[model samples]
Target: MKTVVICAGGPIDELAPLEPYKLSDEVVFIGADKGSVYLLNEGIIPTVAVGDFDSLSSEEFLDLTNRVASVKVASVDKNETDTDLALIHSLDFDPQQVVLVGVTGGRLDHFISVLNSVYRFQKDNPGIQFIVRNKWNEMRLLTPGIIKLTTNPQLPFMSFFAFHENVEEITLTGMKYNVSNETINIGSSRFTSNQLLDEHGSISFSSGICLLIRSSDQ
Candidate 1:
């Protein structure tokens, strides 16, 4: 599969509209734990399901296994979380893109864990693009390089932050709040809420990791 979309077991209210993804034939859906039931509820069947499944009843687990072609059940005590396991499984296919949805609006601990995991996986698999998406936000981690993006009308607000340390020589062009050769430090809010001045905008950082988030009010 060129694109693998993981429906995680986060709050359903936080998930991006699933109907669009369900209608797309190009995307492969992977359900993580309770996410399997969520997908089924939305009339989308996941090809694979991965999780410890403590969140599901015995009957529900059985139903999911029967419906999904590939089911991977792990120990509840395992070190990796259910979402992380689903992400690992997604990499087995070496997809060009792996998107994570239904993951950003639940527990704070879980969200932070997923965010860090995405950062780690993105660094490890530079060829694969990892994304965290929700009802109103899309996030991606960029290493030291230039990234050109077409402005999304739905998500006009763009924000960049240093991953853990200082990001040096940061540059932003074609943006409403353009900056040049700047430095963004950890815990800095200087780059928040910038919009694209044109149809396209560019971001470049010479050092450190940058986290880019495009968001909307909705």
Candidate 2:
């Protein structure tokens, strides 16, 4: 699948190592601001670099330009955050999936901002899948449909929540806690930390969005 991975400049400890992503097929990397430095440190030259880049030192910035293929600079005072800019640019490839990494941790507001962007993008382009993955969590938005899931041995914990409103006609199978024709209302914690009973499972819903989070114990 065609995928665009946007790396933001969040806390390094919170960000998962990019080595695995570098080996994915048909993947393009976008470095937002200091994210370029982070990618370069891991020996991955980004296809494009987009952001204000005020956080980088002169030497670091120079090294980024010398290494990365393209750099799309934005104003520091621009309305979009670095991650937001990266998201916008990611659509240029019309990728089948947009994966965001290094966007969580450090400042909560920044993480929320990226999530708001993800919501908007998911609404605008329903065909492309949007994902936000950090060291401990992998988050995605589930629209009204039947979604097949596979167990992630590394991320054994899974949680689901109603996105904006109550999700109706929910049916789950192959899960430890299966439900049928149920509703997950806003602020419901009933589905938190559920596990897949088998290698595969399914979640079917008819209305509203669901936030699916697969987490690791770490």
Candidate 3:
């Protein structure tokens, strides 16, 4: 498939354009536990639902089962969280890109755990593109390679950080704070909050991983 969107049961203030995806037959939607109810409330039916679903009430769970054709319920005592299981299920469709929504702005513990899962997924599946986005921010995990991005109207500000030790030969072009072959280490805030200078921007590195963030002020 071209794209798959996974909606988790996290707090979502606003969601980006889903009408287009809803109309198109190529896009797949997977709901993680209570996210199924969230999807239905938004007028989009999930193709598949997967989770332990401890968050849902008995009535809600029955309604969900009745609404969605496919439901994979898990044991509440499982190792992975509902979001993680939902993510793994999404891979069955083998989408070119996976956009994660409603996966942020919840419990701090759940947020951090989901972030770690996303990072691990990126590392394991370097060929596929993964994006985590909400109303205010968009995030991507970058492995060693060059990535070019165009200006985003909603999220104009950009930031880059080393995900591992010694992100070597880092270079940035077409940005406010352009760099050339500089190295940055984990926990360093040297490349934070850089804005785009023009229509396009690029980042490249020889080794290590990076977390690229596109965000806007609320």
Candidate 4:
């Protein structure tokens, strides 16, 4: 499957752990105003650099234009956020999966907006997979089906949260905490946190939507 990486302007420290997985050709750097600096430091030339660039000096903006293949400048007055513009551009590539890096670990509003965008994309295209990755966590949305989780062996905590309605008929296997045919609804906080018992675990639900958050404190 074709994969595309969207690099937004956020805390670079949170993304350091992900360096090993970075591939030059598959990345699309979204400047998000000041994010262009981070991309340049990593030696990544963005396919498309976007945002109103209000945070950048004229020199920096000129540097960004010289480095990237295409620079999409928007007005700071636009309705959609910089990240939103980045996502929209990524979709144009018809990628099988989109992985967002440097998207979290900063302002709560931006993080929440990015989360909402993930759900919005899922609603628009049910089959495509979208994931947000930071130093500590990997978040993905699930519709209705079985989700198998094998312990990373490196990072061992797995958690689930309901994004839409509660997830119904949820079942868990091979975990320290187990749940069977239970409903995980908003305000329930039933499945906020769980641990992996064996090397692997599986989750299945009959209906509803949820976000499977696999994380490690390290």
TM-score of each predicted structure versus truth: 0.96, 0.96, 0.95, 0.91
- lDDT for 176 in candidate 1 is 94
**Regions of candidate 4 where Cα sits further than 4 Å from its true position:** 16-18, 24-31
lDDT of 3 by residue, 1-218 (tens): 58989888887575555566788788899999888888888888899999988989999889889989999999989999888988898889988888888888858898788878988898898977888888889999889989987998789899888875668999999999999999889889999899988999899999988889999996
Model 4, global lDDT? 0.80
Q: Model 1, range 1-218, lDDT digits (tens) per residue?
A: 38889999898888888777776777889999998889988888898999988999899888898888888989999999999998998887778999999898869999999999998899899888999999899999988888898989999999999997789999999999989999999999989999998899799989998999999998
lDDT string, candidate 4, 83-114, tens digits:
88888888888888888888888799999999
lDDT of 2 by residue, 1-218 (tens): 99998988999887876777788879999999988888888888899999989999999988988887789999878888988888888999989999998899899999888888998899889899999998889999888999999999989888999987788999999999999999999999999999999999999999988999999888
Which runs of model 2 end up more than 4 angstroms from their true locations?
none
Q: What is the lDDT of residue 187 in candidate 2?
A: 95
What residue pairs are clashing in model 2? none
TM-score of 1: 0.96
Q: Ranking by lDDT, best first?
A: 2, 1, 3, 4
Clashing pairs in 3: none
Whole-model lDDT per candidate: 0.90, 0.90, 0.87, 0.80
